[model samples]
Target: MANPKELDPAESPQAFYGAELRRLRLAKGLSQEALGALVFCSGAYIGQMESATRQPQKDLSERLDVALGTDGHFTRLYPMVTRSRFADYFTAVRELQEMARTIYEYDPVLVPGLLQTAEYARAVFRAFDPLRLAVETDELVSMRMERAHILHSPTRPRYWVVLDEAVIRRVTGNARVMHGQLAHLAQLVRSNRIVLQVLPFSAGGHPLMQGSLTLMTFVDAPPVAYGEGPYRGQLIDDPAYVENCRWAYDLVRSAALSHEASLALIEAAAEDYASEQD
Candidate 1:
């Protein structure tokens, strides 16, 4: 039999959300039987909702609201069919990000999370104020690595990242760690699953000097531009706004190093760091 964990190439988001809800409910110690007792639905009915084989309607949310006794928190079943599960702020962007056929990110300060090496991540995190304890920092690094796992999935998104020269020279980790990361990036380029464009220090003036953004496009939905600062972010779904970001990124890509040149430059940078370590 086929693996239950695999994507159908055309699976609906509703199915994915259902699977998550069921998992979350069970994890929270709610028995299907007990949950059913409160919601006026049989165990089988709850099972159906959990599998995402069943659509969650507004009426069902209203009914579950009264039955679950948690106001609308747990009972407010998300309509994954036409809306994002994320808050109005982030929306279902993460879900969509996972589902995208292609993703493009602009990193003006540091490497985008998807391309970061684990050790490199730790150094970056340490740069944040009020350093976390070692164990806590390790867990945070693990979480970021896990998030990068989506890129390794069979139906993973194709990543195209434009990195600022500042990021390549940020000196996040020890020289050894930085060398390893640059070498790893060159390896990713060889795999051809990723495209890297390096914006040199020479490109002194550009439109994106404002900040960074990650743009994603899915097979079944409109493109989105996610813009963020040090602590704030916004999902731009408006056609005009998204389109504008696209063109701006194009200019940046054009001004950066070409593919072959970028790979050579990365290798050179790695060796330079390796010399520092030695």
Candidate 2:
């Protein structure tokens, strides 16, 4: 069998954290499975953390400290592994998304970031942080808008989105904002830059009722799945885990309306919002 690949700790903060975790675990004569059991997570998750494919959560890091007798080493380094503007768990996903050749998404609520108009995005950030200063909101919206560049890149990924009808039905930023948001989505579809389908309320409960999911495929690396949860997110790179997410996404996609039908629905929503504003 091939030798286990060596990790270069200096490559990144995440790499360093993973390397330290592995070293501490081995010194204690505990396998990944053992450590995971002590921490209430899966061995595969621990393996992903060691390989630097996943970031450790604050809670998990604390548990690792207690279990490995590392005296808070992992916890101290956790903040360094995260990006200031993004959640710690979402940093890896954002990096992978930048390199992906194709992106498939299922959003149960709110417009996906890549498709949000500036006004709509600003509204979202403000609502999420009503107490934030205006400058802070601007900075947040700028960061989100910067991510939209992926949609305009020359080597842009093939984008496909399946939206639950509630995403469009909800009035996020009043009638004007909803109208612009839906119109923007329709424009992307008309430009043939994206493939979109709406999973109508009539479809009833479905495979992705849990939350949002993004499956990204790369030209030179294995696929990954990023799942969103309340106040946190998860990035899955394990082959088997990614495949399972892909299967679920396929089910959700199948349950959505046909492309033509979905487009019509979006256009009608936009018109309704516009009329409401008038």
Candidate 3:
């Protein structure tokens, strides 16, 4: 068997937690499998935690404390490791995005974060909280741009997105910003970086009209779904619920324009924005 990969404790809070967990487990003379058995999870899960590839949950941390006789070490460190630049509710979803092998998204009102240009992201953030300071807005934009880096990774997930017509029709920031944003989307589509479908206004009504949904599938774990609204988000891992989200996504896809048609529509929208800019 191959030796386990080495972890750098200095990488991040999660890495430190993972390294510490490994140290403690070894000190207790327990293999990952043995420790996982005691915690009621799979050895692969323990290995993932040790490698900082998986985020540790509160309940799992508590269980690790009990199994490793660490007296709440993991439980106490959990919050620090989970702290994120994203919203509290979105922390887990961000972590899962890094591990997903495929990602499917449906947006009804705006461009998805992963596909947003810096100016577009700033505009959205400013609109969401007009009272926010410029520095704070900059920080949020930086974090968002950092998240977009995953798409450029060699092992980036296969991304498929369905966008409602309003996403492109609604003017964000100004005509210039909208033109740039739409142009960026067109470039991405033309380069085959992502599969995009537009759900036109003529589609009438759809099952996912209420909110946005993201479904992610992993290589070694079960699929999960994320639903988001104005200021709230929920991460769902229950097989039944995830399956239902998948079904809704399929229905939405059926109601959306074909990839080629969608690209043409996006290009036309961009041209309209450009005309307005002139």
Instruction: Look at candidate 2 and give me any clashing residue pairs.
Output: none
Q: How far is candidate 2 from the true structure (C-alpha RMSD, Å)?
A: 8.8
Cα distance off (Å), candidate 3, residue 153: 1.5
Please tell me which predicted candidate would have the highest lDDT against the true structure.
3
Evaluate all candidate structures by whole-model CA lDDT and list the values in order.
Answer: 0.72, 0.84, 0.86
Q: Lowest summed-lDDT stretch of 10 residues in model 3? A: 83-92
Show how many residue pairs clash in every candidate, following the order shown: 1, 0, 0
Higher-lDDT candidate of 1 and 3: 3
Ranking by lDDT: 3, 2, 1
- lDDT (tens digit, per residue) of candidate 3 on 102-156: 9999999999999999999999999999999999999999999999878888999
Highest TM-score, which number? Answer: 3
Which residue pairs clash in candidate 1?
A: 86-91
lDDT of 1 by residue, 12-125 (tens): 555554565465565667776666667565564455445433345565556665654546743444544336422233334555566678899898998887778999888888
RMSD of 1: 10.0
Q: Model 2 — which ten-residue stretch has the worst lDDT?
A: 82-91
Q: What's the TM-score of every candidate structure?
A: 0.68, 0.73, 0.76
The order by descending TM-score is: 3, 2, 1
